[model samples]
Structures are given as C-alpha cells and as structure tokens.
Target: MDTTQRALAVGVGAALLQALMLIAFAWPAANIAPRDLPIAVTGPQADLVVGQLAERSPGAFDVSRPADEAAARAAIEDRDVYGAIVTGDGPPRVLIASAASPAVAQQLTQIGQQLSGGPAARVDDVVAADSDDPRGTAFGAMVLPLALSGIAAGVLLGLLIPTIGGKALGLATFGVVGGLLSMEVIQGWMSLVPGPYLVLAAVAGLVSFAVSGAVVGLSAAIGRAGIGIAALTMLLVGNPFSAATSAPELLPKPWGAIGQLLPPGAAASLLRSVAFFDGAGASGPLAVLVIWAVAALTLLGVGALRTRPANEPATAAPIPVTTG
Candidate 1:
C-alpha cells in the first residue's frame, strides 16, 4: 500500500478511538446514582420507621438512627445527611434542610404522608427556603451563569492559542452569540422555561462572562491542555450532573450527592434561589463560583506576566582601534 493510504488509515483509527473514549466517559457519568447518603431518623418509633423505609425503598435511601430531633437537625445543618424523618403521634413528619434542595424536602414529605396510611404528613423545613421560590426551577438559573462564563473563557483561550487563534476566536464568538440567541428563543418562542426576561438576561450575561474568562485564563496558563481540561471540567462533567434537568432529590443518589459541587450545579442552584425561590438560600453556590472565577483569573494573570517580553539594554559597540 502507498504511504498516503497508510497515513489515512492511521488517522481514521485514531479518530475512532477518541470518539469511543468520549462516549465511554459520558455514558456512566450521565447515569450516576447516590449509594449511601447519610440520613437521620428520630422519634418514638424511629427504629420501626427507619426499617420500613429502608426495606421499602431499598437502594434509594439509607437510614441513620440519630439520637434525637435536635441531633438530626444538627446532622442536616452540618450537611452530614441529605434528609431526616421524624415520627410523631398523628403522622410521621419529614424534616428537610431547605438549603439542600427544597424539591427533595417536598418529595420526602409526600412519601411520609403516604406511609402514614391516610393521615396528612407535616413538613418542617428546618432550613426554610425563601417563600417566593418555586420548586424544580432553581437548577436552570444557577447553572446558566457558570456555563456562560466557561464558554467565554474557552473563546478567549482559542483566540490566544498560537496556531488556532482565528478558528478558535470564530468558534468562541459563535458559541457566545448562539447561547444568547438560544435564551431568547427559549423565552420568547418556546416558553418551555419561564422566568423574568430581564433577570434571565442578566444571569445569562454574568454566566457567559465568568465562564469565558475562566476558559481563556486556563488556555493562557497551559495552552492546548488548558482548553481540554476546561471543557472536561466545565462542560462535560459539570453539565450532565448539573441537577438542572432533575433536582438532586429526583436524581439517583450518586449524581445527587456531588451535584452541588459541580460548577453548573452550584450556579443552577443559586439561580433557582434567585428566580424561583426568592434568593433565600443560595449563598453557598454563589460563593463556590466566585472562588472559582477569581482563582482562574489569578492564574491567567500570572501566565500573562510570564509570557511578557523581558527588558534588556542593548550593548554599545566597542570603540574602533586606529589602523597602524
């Protein structure tokens, strides 16, 4: 076979290998489930109740028998457990930490009520959410800002890369423009996701800026590797486990537990608090994002400094000697 034919065959094989690897990584990441989330059970019949819940739910819940209600509340407050169930005279009460995810709390309430054989279950939101917030909507707003910011960072990186500057810039521009346009289409035409337009726009802008800055900063620091890492961290790992499409409570255990830490997950929760939940309990996620953005920018700045040309004075020519 000709050398050209061999080269083509090798290139095709490499491309196929890359495609398969991506698919393999994405598949399991998408379907992660929580295995052993810490949970507390309290009250007179706590033992029986915990057992029932464990037996009935099986892999869905792991029950922990806390000493008392105060202990259970403390567990939740400290983020030791995802939730707690408290049994009372009339019906079982499920106490949830609102800071975790309001939707999950509500679902637990419903589940407790069903278990109690027609008696209405009482819900005590130990960490109360802002009253104005709606359920199942926090994830989108929280994720929007970070996702946009990451995109911006990626674009900047592309522009600065020595060989791919023009192409990277073009792609980055398209992503930013396309992302904004998508928001418009979603709000105006589809109406599938609802919120205040002005607020949504603001969120979109902030997220896009932050994310773009991060991507650019990363690329500046490490060149091509930085871009790949940013994409992996921000887009691939961050988006699927984002908790936007499904609240953490609704998701299986594994995905639910780590969702809060991912960039998209953090931003989505914060946005949900602002838009649907009255911004009652979003400080944690907001803080996480601020730290990430600041850190990335710092790295970018240092990288830029290192790339600057060094200052050096030109040496003067030696005095010419007279010929004998």
Candidate 2:
C-alpha cells in the first residue's frame, strides 16, 4: 500500500484496538454476576437455604452441603468456597472470607440478611482482608502495574540485549527486583497483603518473571511481532478476564476459568492464596505460573538454537590462494 493508504490503515487499526480494549475491560465488569460460585450451606435449614438461593439467583452459586457450621467454616478457610451459610441456630450466620473475595462476602452477607426475614443475620468474616485494603480494591489494582512493568522489561531486553542468554538473565534480575519492590509497596507500605514477607515476595517475583519471560521469549522466538502477540494475550485477554478485582466465578462463564489459565489471573489467585488463606488452594495457580515460566524458557531455547549458526566461526579460506 502507498504511504497515505498505510497511514489510514494504521489509524483504522488504532481505532479498532481502542474498541477491543474497551470491550476487554468493560465486558466483564458490566456482566459482573456470580455464575456457579461455590458457597457452603449446612444445618437443619441447609436444603431450604439452598433451594432459596437457587430460586433467587438461579445458578449463581454452587451450593455445597458441608456437614455442619464448623465444616462450613472449614470449607471457607480451605478456599473450597467463598463463604458459608449456617442455619438451624437463632439467626442465620454467614461465614465469609473477605480476603478471598470482598464482593462475594458482601453478596453472602446480603443473602444472610435476606434469610433472617427480620433482623440482619450475623455475619462473621473468617479471613478478613488487611484494613488498609479492606475491600481489596488496592490489592487488585496492583496487577496492572506489574503487567505493564513486565511488558516494558520484555521490550527493553528484546531491544537492548542482543543475545538470548543475556535477555534471560535480564528477565531473571528484573523479576526478582520487581517482586521485592512491588511487595514492599503493597505489603510493607500499603499493607495490602497479610502473608509472610518472603513467601509473598517469592510468589510475586515468580509472577513477574513469568510475564516478562513470556514476552521476551516470544519476541526472541518470533521477532518483533511476538511482542504484539504477548501484549494482546497478556493485557487484553489475561488481565481483564483475570478476575483480580473480583472472584473468577463472578465473571462470565468459561471466561473466568480461562483467565485463571493465564499469567495475570493465576498470579492474582496465587497471591490471594498466600496472602490470606495460608496458601490454601494455591496449587492450580502456582502450576499455571510455573507452566508459563517453563514455556518462556523453552521459547528462549528455541530462539537460541535458531540463531546459533549466525554466531559460529566461519570456515577458514584456502591460504594457498596467496602463494603468488
């Protein structure tokens, strides 16, 4: 295409990208309602409560009948469910792990109140979030900066560092430092996460390494286009669908689940796990991050192999040609 045509095309592309970004970020938020979110219900009124929930919200909650109130509390703590409804006592009690999801806790609290028919039911927060970030708004907000930072790291390494090995080292260093610095701000300064310092730092570091490594590895394997690919994958799809600001089940069907498979979503879940539930239900997210990191390494290796011959010593020319 001619220059004018190409410029026009670029403009159109930018507009299209803007529309896409809007949809990616807004769609989930607009449609923020629980779908199959797990909640435990127990006691003499368990069946009635479950029926009422199903009637009221219809498929919004995955009601589990834990043995009793204690069992229901255990479920919440184990991260098996976001909250629990305990009946058979005076007023229905709602057990919530606000750290797991403040939004869900609020929903459950409303449900508890509804169940009481008169006075508001007793609501107990089994795992409360940090007072500094009680609603988890600040905690969830951290993912964007981390993601942007990782993207920047990848772009810088790809442009400045010529060798795959050098890029790899840079990714590692960036991951470690980024993790520590971010935790210091979120955990130390803001008091966002309540987990152990070292543990949270390590998880945060891994998250950084995974995202940056993925971007860098993609660029190395596929040239400049790879950066675009990584950005679209991580930013548009992963970040929005991540449900970092809310629970995965709170999002649209399958998308929330899909988000958890990506780096940002996995990182959010893993961070929450370590921060509040003492690493409960952390395996899946941890695995996802590890898989991403491994894939990044593999991509870097492939890129190195592809570029190796360019660095090899040239064959010696015949010296006999100088015998004149």
Candidate 3:
C-alpha cells in the first residue's frame, strides 16, 4: 500500500481498537465490585471481624489490623488503607477516606451497616473529595485530555526539532510549562483538584514527560506506526482501566492492576496522591513514571541509531590553510 493507504489503515485500526476497549471498560464501571480491596480493622474483635467478613464475602476485601482508630485514620490519610472498620464499641463505625475513593467509602459504610444487621453504620470521612466536585470527576476528566496533550506535544516537537537532543529538550520544556498551566486551570480556576501547587505541577510535568517520551520513542523506532501504537496503548487501553473516578479495586481483574502500570494510570494515581492523600502512595507510581521515562528515552536513542543511513559518510575534516 502507498503512504496514504497505510496511514488510513493505521487510523482505522487504531479507532477500532479504542472503540472496542471503550465498550469493554465503560460497561464495567457500573458493575464495579471490590476484589481484594484493602481496608483496615481495629479493636479487640479485629480478628473476628476479619474472619466474618471473609466468610460473608470471600475475596471482597483484603483486611489489615491497625493499632487503633487513630492509626487506621492515619493509614487512610496516607492512602495506605482505603477505609477502616472499628469494632468493639456499640454498632461498629466505618472510617472512610472518601477523597481516595467515594465508592469504596460508600461500600464499606454499607457493609458496616449490614454487619450488625441493624440501622446504618456511623460513617466517618477522614479525607473528603473537593466539595466543588465531590465525586472527584476531574481525575477522569484529566485522563483522556492529558493523553491527547501528550500526543500533540510529541507531534509538534517531532515536526519542529530535527535532532534527538532537541526533541528531548522540547519534551521536557513542554512538560514543565504544560504542567504549570494545567495547575492554573484545574486547581486555580476550577479548584476541582486540591494539592500543593508545586507538588501538583511537578507531578503533572513528570506525567507529560512520560507520555511525550513514549510517543517520541515510538515515532522514531517504528516510524508512524510507533506513534499509533503508543497512542492506542496509552489513551485507549490506559484511560478507562485507570479507574480514575473510582478506586483501582473497583476495576475488573488484571485490567485494574494493569492500568496502574501505564503512563495515564500512573499519572492519575500520582495526581490523586498529591491532591488529597498528603503525597501518600506517590512513591510507587512515581517510580513507574521514572521507569517509563528511562525506557522510552533509551528507545528513542536506539531508534535514532538504527534509522541513520548506512551510506551517510562522516563530515570531511577542514583542510589546513597553506598561506599565512
């Protein structure tokens, strides 16, 4: 096929792949169920509570023991634990980090109410989502748009910068600038996401760098096909599986875990950590971003080496002047 034909084919294939993934993932959003979702437990009956929960719903939760409600609350704030169940007192109280995942908090609250087969359990929200956007939909909003922005940045860099070094520098510059701008828009104007300004900007920059690096590397390595591959993997497969609007546990099976490994998912998680969890749970996803940046940059170097023409000779040295 000619260049145009191949481009059309790629576009169609990418669209089809993304469309199918959208259907597959969106349907499960409403069907979300916790699979080994982590929660903390405190009080003397912690053991009994864990055992009963296991019996009642196998694999629904992964329970841990905290020293007390204070520790449990600390865990929630740090994003180490999503919610907690405090027993031993009259009518067990469920502690939630609604900021981390409202759906998770709600589910735990419902479970607490059902535990005693009595009225609703007392729900405590240790960290709540932004009041303006209580459901924290901004995370979901950011996912696709961020991915697109990454692609646009990559395309512009590739077109404007002819050298690998230039492209890399451009990517970094775009990341930093775009990140700050995003902070102004999301945090300043909307106040939809709340976090330390510098922290949010830094995380956003890193995320943009990761995405742009992947695109640039792919474009260099596989030509146009690489860009398509990167886009499909990042935007299509990564977005919905990210579970930005809900806890990662709510996503189905491996896809949930899989999302956290990708750029879009890692970025969303990192942003969440900065925005609400006091920078908790940031390390793992931050490491993931670093790995992507290193690997993609390396790939870009390799592709550059491979694509250089064999016949292109080294520049001839300048001849020495004979006359003074």
Clashes of 2: 0
Best by lDDT: 2
| Candidate 3: residue pairs that collide | none
lDDT of 3 at 200: 92
lDDT per residue (tens digit) for residues 156-229 in model 2: 98888999889999989998898898899988987778879988988889988888888889988988889889
Instruction: Show model 2 residue runs off by greater than 4 Å.
Output: 321-324
TM-scores for all candidates? 0.59, 0.96, 0.87
Please write out the lDDT profile of model 1 over residues 107-216, one tens digit for every residue: 57777788777667777777654444335354345455457555664665556554333433443454466446656865566453455766565555445545665666
Worst 10 residues of 2 by lDDT: 315-324
Ranking of predictions according to lDDT: 2, 3, 1
Query: What is the Cα-based TM-score of model 1?
Result: 0.59
- Which is the winner by lDDT between candidate 1 and candidate 3? 3
List, residue by residue over 1-324, the lDDT tens digit for candidate 3: 999999999999989977888786676686699998999999988888899899988998888898999999988888878999998868788898778887787889889989867887788889998898877666578777777898778767765677777888888898899889988888899888887998898888888888888888888776777777887778667777877878778888888899999988888888888888888899999999999889878977877786677436989999988986
In model 2, the clashing pairs are: none
